[model samples]
Target: MKNTIFTITLILVGLIATSCSSDSSDNNLNTAESLQAVTDLALSGTWVISSFIESGTDETDDFTGYVFTFNSDGSLVADNGTMTVSGTWSVTSDDSSDDDDDYDSDDDIDFNIFFAAPPTFEELTEDWDIVSRSASRIELIDISGGNGGTDTLTFEKN
Candidate 1:
């Protein structure tokens, strides 16, 4: 009868909805894994600044031809054809802390760069949030630079 048909239709709709929801969650997991793979491959090579923004101003020209090399041992060397600057570099996942069970790593990755002396690239040394990353490039953002300005840095693998 009509009652049985109505019940069957409702059940079918519920099953379809449940199946779609589960697929989305699986897709999210896959995206996270893909991003992590890209980060691992991108970190060990010579890179150059593709874009640099400080306080809403483009400063990419200042670092033209400068090469930055990153090693697996947390060492970094910046070579500008004339001089070299030594520093350290690292990337931390947002959920790396053991105490934060509710933390989500998909949206909270951070990149750190430290220098011993004055760096040729101003405001480049900071704990920056990874906005986006790929096997050949990484986009970073520092919302707080202690100078009330945002810093954006992008590096492309050479």
Candidate 2:
């Protein structure tokens, strides 16, 4: 009788463990989906350059009064209240190059901005690291510039 009872207890424990594992997997999936949704929503909006820092110097006024519109289809339009320049933008995962397996690291996302227009706007292009992001703001940093200068760009909803 003791042997049978011991067998039943072991089986029950295994079943409970499996159930808990399944729930944890589901929770992880939900978390991933939520994060992606937040990123998408934050990118699809009209933003203005609230702050622009290059090589530790401020250059926010370079884009003053300009509004950048990021469409869901990866198209971007920058309007300086007179003329508009078209471009493309995309957000991608940078996990492949991550040195560590830390899933919560901010360096896991790459915010790429591309433009082909007046030379002035070219400075705003790069595959930047997503330092931070929210519903009303996004902060990006580029540390791989050929000039060995770091660039930080902050955009706030307009």
Candidate 3:
């Protein structure tokens, strides 16, 4: 009788442990999916520079100069001149979603940081705040100077 009781107790403990483990695993998977969804909404493609403007200047140049790719692997290539500069980037958020204005009620959003680039403009090096994001469009603001303007960059999935 003692042996049987010990076996049943052990079995019950094992089952409880297994159940808890599976629940934890499910939570982890959900967290990963949430992160991927946010990244997909933010980064996973090519972004074209629709507009470029300097601070305190009425002059806005519609140059072919632009940034071509920003990858989730922290790699980026920007075409400013004849030269192509490459660097790693990082992303952060004031909260999980940076600013609420950048997303719809159903949208997920995040902020990104750019590092190690050629000194082109103070705006480029500064923290690029994602003002709004959607399936095909992204609005970014240069939070560098209080005078920083917004750029609406559009992309098609390639």
Best by TM-score: 2
lDDT of 3 at 54: 53
- Model 3, 1-158: lDDT tens digits are 99999999999999999999999887666656655665666476666655555554432243255555777787767666686767655554333444344323223323454546445432355444555556766555543335434433233333
In the range 56-156, model 1's lDDT, one tens digit per residue, is 99989977888988777888888988988888877655554432222223454557788876655536888776666777888777765256677789999
lDDT of 3 at 8: 100
Ranking by lDDT: 2, 1, 3
Whole-structure CA lDDT of model 2? 0.77
Q: Which wins on lDDT, candidate 2 or candidate 3? A: 2
Residue 143 in candidate 1 has what lDDT? 67
Clash pairs for candidate 1: none
Instruction: Indicate the worst ten consecutive residues by lDDT in candidate 3.
Output: 102-111
Candidate lDDT scores, in order, read 0.74, 0.77, 0.54
Any residue pairs clashing in model 2, and if so which? none
lDDT of 2 by residue, 13-128 (tens): 99999999999887667656645764676566789999999888998987898999988788889999798989898776655664222222354566778888777678788877
Q: List the residue pairs that clash in candidate 3.
A: 102-132
Report the Cα lDDT for candidate 1: 0.74
Best by lDDT: 2
What are the runs in model 3 whose C-alpha is more than 4 Å off?
Answer: 1-35, 56-63, 96-110, 144-158
